[model samples]
Target chain A: MNYLHKELYNLLISDHHIFDFIRESALDGLWYWDVENPENEWMDGKFWTTLGYDPEQMPHKSSAWQDIIHQDDLKVALENFKKHCEDPNHPYDQIVRYKHKNGHTIWVRCRGMAIRDHNGKAIRLLGAHNEVSALKKHEEILKRCNSAASIGYWEIDFISEKVLWSTLTKEILEVERDFTPTINETLAFFSEGKSKTSLLNAYQNAISKGESYELELPISISKEKTKWVKIVGIPQITANKCTQIYGTVQDIDLRKTNELKLREEREKLRISEESFRANFEHAAIGMAILNEKGQWLKVNNKLCEIVGYSQEELRQLTFQDITFPADLDADLVLFQELMDGKRDHYQMEKRYFHKDGHIIYIILAVSIVRNNEGKILYVVSQIIDISELKEAKNKIHSLLKTSQEQNNRLKNFAHIVSHNLRSHSSNIGFMIDLLTNENEKLTEKEEYKLLKTASNNLAQTIQHLNEVAMIQTTLEENLQAISLSNSIKSAIENVAAIADAAQVKIINEIKPDEVILGLPAYIDSIVLNLLTNGIKYRSENVDSYIKISSFHSMQYKVILFEDNGKGIDLEQYGSQLFGMYKTFHRHPEARGIGLFITKSQIEALGGRIEVESEVNKGSKFKIYLKNEKDKKPMYHR
Target chain B: MKKTKSLCIIDDDPIYTFGLKKIIEFGKFDVETIFYENGKEAYENLSQVISDGESLPDLILLDINMPIWNGWKFLDEFTKLLSEPSVVVYIISSSIDPKDREKATEYQIINSFIVKPVSIDKIREILQSN
Candidate 1:
């Protein structure tokens, strides 16, 4: 008996050590309740402490413990405990909040087992209470965060094929808490077509392979509208078989829509840029892009052709290198205005240097490119070659000048003709008046002389007018090569009889090989007129002496005819020397039409005749003709 | 017929002047003839006469083209004279330019614009009309 008592004490000692170990570890608390005697229920000190009460002030019966439980949780906890008491093999587990002595509530997980007699009827209940206050607080925080972030959690049961969704998950689907949805029904809530197919495939893959999947898909919550969601699913695997899929679903509709809009805008910008490049490269007019420093940034093929430079060469050159010196200042001023943001475009008539060292006139239009912030980027220039237009304008100007000069000449000719014809006709009228007034008083000889002089003067004036008309009309044809020496000799020979009668000396200094381009008849008339004038105006005191000389100019063959004769005052007759019917001397042969005819003939052949004279000195007439091939001609008798 | 009180011949041609003077003298026209070589001399003399309160010429035979102040300028100045006299002007011009004829017709004071070589019959007609 003493040995048994010692052994029993050792067993009690080991049991005490085991209980002490549990208390120190704070693993769990134990409690005992007598179901047969309802008033004798007791909780361990650790169990009372887990429920936030002292063991000395612990609740004594089940009713006392039940009174401290939360009113909403008391019924559930008591029912579970009764079931555990009836079935001894079953354990009861529940989470409940109980009030502490300090007036605060604490969360505890209660687990109990039934202690039964030999017939399997439970006599007492043993249980443990674990304080889960910290775990409850952490779970509350997680729930709050999920609701605020619009994130919801869901679980799918693999064996039962049932879906369990948290309250927040139901809110994300815009459904009620009682709504139970299958996997297909859940996929149906996703937008139809590609989004639904993609989500269904991802779900199927996660269930079969226990794979994790994250997808953003559009979801149609009801018939009217749709929204975007980001779904992440992680399969739970046990024994290499998927038991369930747990996932998070978040509403991301706003961000997805914004991303789509941004993509569309980018596509539009790319198309616009392509069109701009095509227009700039293929334009018909010469175009160039220039940097702010006037360096060529880009040059098109047309610009290359205009400047006679390759694109590569032009890129290395500044605008100043090609700009004409005269147009540079004006171009720079307009460019400065563009840079200053005062103007967007400018146009000017300017000149550029051609590669071949010629000036190219152009009408240039320039526009400045700027960014949204109004900073100048570069200059775009369009150049139109206008050199041909300028040349045509110059030609028209010269033509106008020639026409004006011709009009003036025609006016003067008309005036002179009127004056000459009127004078002659008026003289005839006077003579007729005199004859009529003296019809009975005139003798036959005197009347005959008067009639003869009148008839002779009329015939002479008519012949002189005919000669003037002939000279004006006949020399319209272009000049041809004619022998100058032969022409001079022929002219002198024609007047040899008159010269010999006047004892005139003819001196010829003409080069025998000299030739000129002039009308044949014009040369003859010019030579004859000068020779006859010199002989007619011969000085009364001295015998006539004439000098004829010829020479060649750079573009003309010149002939000079000078005579020592009765030279008239040049200042009085210089302007009228070639005027018709203008007589300086009172000689009978001085009809004043000779020099006029000579001048007209010379001018018709594009030649010029000028005279220099002094009173009683010599009159020198210089005639210029175009230089032509030297031709030897047959002399005429 | 009442002879003109004062007759003036403004011409640049000497022959025309001489012939006119001879005809006036031979016909015994009761008129004192005044001759000027050009419009400038005629304008000066006529203006001087008007300033001295003398009678203006009754008839003026004017030539168109002259060295200084042609017939058109003479008429422009002559119309401004203060003296009141019955005057008849005949423009005797050798110019065949139609523009000159048109210009002469534009003047309200010109009695007749005739071509050159004035005939005795025309002159008689003009004198009888006056």
Candidate 2:
């Protein structure tokens, strides 16, 4: 030190160039100050240049450096200098910032020493500056990177039994920078159970065994806020003993929460898939999945049973291959419509060729599966076997046809009976007429009178049979729209003589606009027969009157034939009034065939006959006929 | 009334024909009566008489529902043979069926449709009308 001091003093008084060259090469700059005269100081040229200023433009004075120095850094330097002067053992070294001539900060390592005269009075001060701005900039970048990545450092010093937290670690724990927690307090940030235990074990291993560990653990920042963190501990071992344990704590809450949700979704999807599989396997009806080209991609056991094929066999064939030719086209048309996006699903009764070669009838329902873009993925078909039902329906149809044929034959036989009886009755009448005209004595005989009566009875019976047969043979197709009032008028005209003789007045009250659909002949017969019946059954005690009126029912045009005469006892004869050969009255003209025929005629026109009568007050016969404006079609008897 | 020179009766029922003939005779008309059992027989004999250029009966009674050919079938064929027949014809039927009465009106040759059990008075009226 004496030799270097001798050389530096020799250079300072002799060749000053070498001393200045050594200062420029060894340090950023050097300074000298006169303590007694505080403003008097000298700064080397390198200091000004380091601050982005030309040395010749800077003054060689203390104030020149102080003006460019950071205000906070200047105070630190001054304090350090005062301590150093009071006790030379104290180092006057620190990092200080200076403003560059370009308006940017320049960081420098500044050191100073106080030179004192005899009796410890400081006379001069010397200082050195070294630029460290680039290194400082790099440290700032790393600090920002750690905060951006949500990573923070923590340390446990075993020797001092102290815990240290970085600024970001304090931020993550929601603590103030002044908070200095004990080691146990730091461990309290871990969750109460598994998280705390796991971290404690990892910390113990790190301290005792010098083991490094990484763990994802749950931690609580406050009473209500919880987070998941990836905590890692790396041990620093010295002399085979851990001196410190330090690592990083990273926030992983977002990733772990998403992972948990994904797992739950996967579990739910798996359960749904299992249930769907069970349903598909155990379904009652046949089910199948097929490609758009009609190829079977899958078939359930029920489907195989319905088609008389195995599942594997069905998968080898397309629907078109097994479909009955006659029904295939219709099925294809509907399927095409589904594929063309015209329909979402379809149902049709179709026939298929069974594996055993017989035709099988089925009701097939089909729907499509589609991708998100609306392209068809596949087709799902449900089939129900209907062959047995079809067979039963055919049997019923044939049975109905057979019954209809038998009924027609019976009606024809009735006609034949009437025709044959009429011929024989005509012969009998002729014989009776001849016998009576030829011999008066023969006609006077009791036997001859009896024979005439028999013949008359035979004629009447034949007439009744003919009338019944005519009603049966009448076809609904022969019905015409006949005015009700006109028919009643004509019937009244025909019965005028008889009605007048009996003192029975027949008043036609039917409106002229009322029309009915019926056979013209049958309508006339019914009206006339009712008119005669009203007159024939007239009470001898009162003035007999017959009234005809028309109205409408649900599907029928009703004509009411009311009479003020010796009415029938409805309770006694109501059920038998419309029966053939039924006799209710003692009148000779009560053949008992009129009401029966009328009822049959009404029924043949898709109508009915209803009667209401009292013993002596009056009788009402309501005849229903098909209404011309009604929607019901005429029905044949 | 013009006296009927000849009368023809076509009926399948012998009793009906006999009674009708007896009535015509009892009326004391000087008319010669001819009878045929069915429409076919009457048609053949009448067509022959007309082709032979002989006069037909003044009045002819045709019965429907006969054997071999019905009254309607005979009328159809007989009318084609004669343009305007001079004979007055009547349809006699035992059938009370109104359909037969309505069908008889379709033939221009038929003067009237009469139901069976015709009274002697009706026969007398027919004879005088003829």
Candidate 3:
């Protein structure tokens, strides 16, 4: 025994005062009991006082303390005391709960020793008491915190080849409280792929190099469940060798899954943004982004090419700067609508000024982007160059104007030629007639006959020219409303003698009130010519009849003259039917000038004529004239 | 029958006037024929005759295509001067254009329109009608 213990034993045996002094100095609570009597016992005042009790009011029996002790703890204490009395090998130290005077439990650690007689039989029991309620409360708080935080503690001792796991750590690994795991078995809890390999490498490095690591890895909890865990391994080094490694294993499965999902969303957003950038940079049509003030924010390569500017140069300029001055007002008006929230997009054919100072035609489409509050953010514009198309259109317009002017000049020249020619031919014929009349012997001469024939032909040719010139000259003459029936009746009367000689019946089917817009002279001439033609070309096989009718189309008045005559074959004579001097028949009067003059007169009234003819059946001549009654202003002069 | 006692011919073409005078002679019409080169000359000489208190020509043949004054202008001025002309008038021209014929009818002084190269029978018809 140590001197202190021997002195304590000597004080306990020789003097109770010295033992009391020792107890007061070093112990919180002291006790003494008589094992042989089993009832008598002593407890210091401080022991009752620590439990919120007064020693004077307490019982001096062992059962008094027993009744106040926890029932389960009393049973354990009794068993341990019995074992200590029998073999004196088992310890009699235990943490027990005691009821306090305030009705709350107090925690205490009790330690006792048996005082034996010479025969080694138990005589008395002496014990010390330490109140540990604050310590117990702190331990309870730590365990609750670990469980709440899903943090478990673990340690590995390399020298002893031992592994220790806290109660919460065992729970994290999903093992029973009594189950023990070796180093390799503990490592098996990590998932079989990256987690296992990384952990194994980390552990090896820690044991050999005394390095530390903190890693988040996945752990298999069950056949179908995997959990993410954060492990921190800290190696304890002694003399430059690793002797232990210990750290926390935390369950981070929820946090890690949410983090992974957020990263995937970010990656997807990045890819979409990249693709949009690619499309903008390489678009087929010119594209640009502009601010609300019309300043260019970004321009694609195609836009640069169309505007004949570098992207850097364009970005410094506003859209209004490059826009053609005449086209700016229209573009701004539409832009104002977008700003006012009246429209979101607009499209127009607009002009822009190229860098080289030429006008460029473009089809521009603009769309405005707005914020949640409806404020304009920016505008996107798509431009298609149409300069080539505009140039071609302008070229065609000028060509059409030139051709129309030339055609008018040609008509004027033809009229002048016919007028001058007619005068000369008339003089020649008159001289020929005078010669034939004055000198009857000269007409009987063969050469005189030829001269007469030639003179007659010259007059006929001049007459045809005069007829054609009349149409050209009368084109601009004022037209009057003429009664179709009256005009046709007069024409029939004029050709009545010829029709009667040809034995041709004439039928007028026109309504008596039918009226048309034309020069009265032209109407008379056109009707007379058709009447003469019908009589002259009467089919010998049939009773020739000439029918005249009038009808109205959408914008024209149609006059039809149907004749049962030896109709000219249209297929053989269609193109030359209206050509001047193109005689198609051997009739002595088939001068071919009548139909030609008729077609020309119809055209002078802004009309057209069509002929439907069969070789021997009949011919139908339809003349289409403008129906100017309802709409006279367009055809007036 | 009223004889065409005095006749006047206005034309720019000498050949046309000659042929017309020959036809009148061949018709054996007892008429004195006078000739002017154009409408301006005819108007001046006829105005002098009116001013001198001499009788106007019994008939006047006017040509449309002329220099200085066309036939239509002479008729317009002369008709305004004399509201009703005692002399018969005919508009004779080589122009076969219907517009020209239509225009001649607008004048009260005009008696008729005759196409050029007047044949012997046409002249006899005109003299006998007068």
What is the full ranking by TM-score, best candidate first?
Answer: 2, 1, 3
Per-residue accuracy of model 3 over B8-89 as CA lDDT, tens digit each: 8888888898898889888787888999887788888888888898888888889998889889888877776574678889
Q: Write the per-residue lDDT of candidate 1 for residues A296-365, one digit (tens) a residue.
A: 9998888898899999999999988999998999999998998888899999999999999998899999
Candidate 2 residues A1-75, lDDT tens each? 699989888878899788777788989988888888988888888888899998887777788877878999889
Note the residue pairs that clash in candidate 1: none
TM-score of each: 0.57, 0.62, 0.53
- Whichever of 2 and 3 has more DockQ, that candidate is 2
Q: What level of docking quality does candidate 2 show?
A: acceptable
- Give the winner by lDDT: 3
Which number leads on TM-score?
A: 2
In model 1, which regions exceed 4 Å deviation?
A: A1-130, A137-151, A167-171, A190-211, A222-226, A236-240, A343-349, A363-365, A368-377, A384-637, B1-6, B18-32, B43-57, B75-82, B86-88, B95-111
Q: Is candidate 2 or candidate 3 better by TM-score?
A: 2
Candidate 2 regions with alpha-carbon error over 4 angstroms: A1-361, A366-379, A385-392, A414-419, A472-481, A500-513, A538-557, A562-574, A613-619, A631-637, B1-4, B38-40
Residue pairs with backbone atoms closer than 3 Å in model 2 (clashes): none
Q: What C-alpha lDDT, on a 0 to 100 scale, does residue A280 get in candidate 2?
A: 80
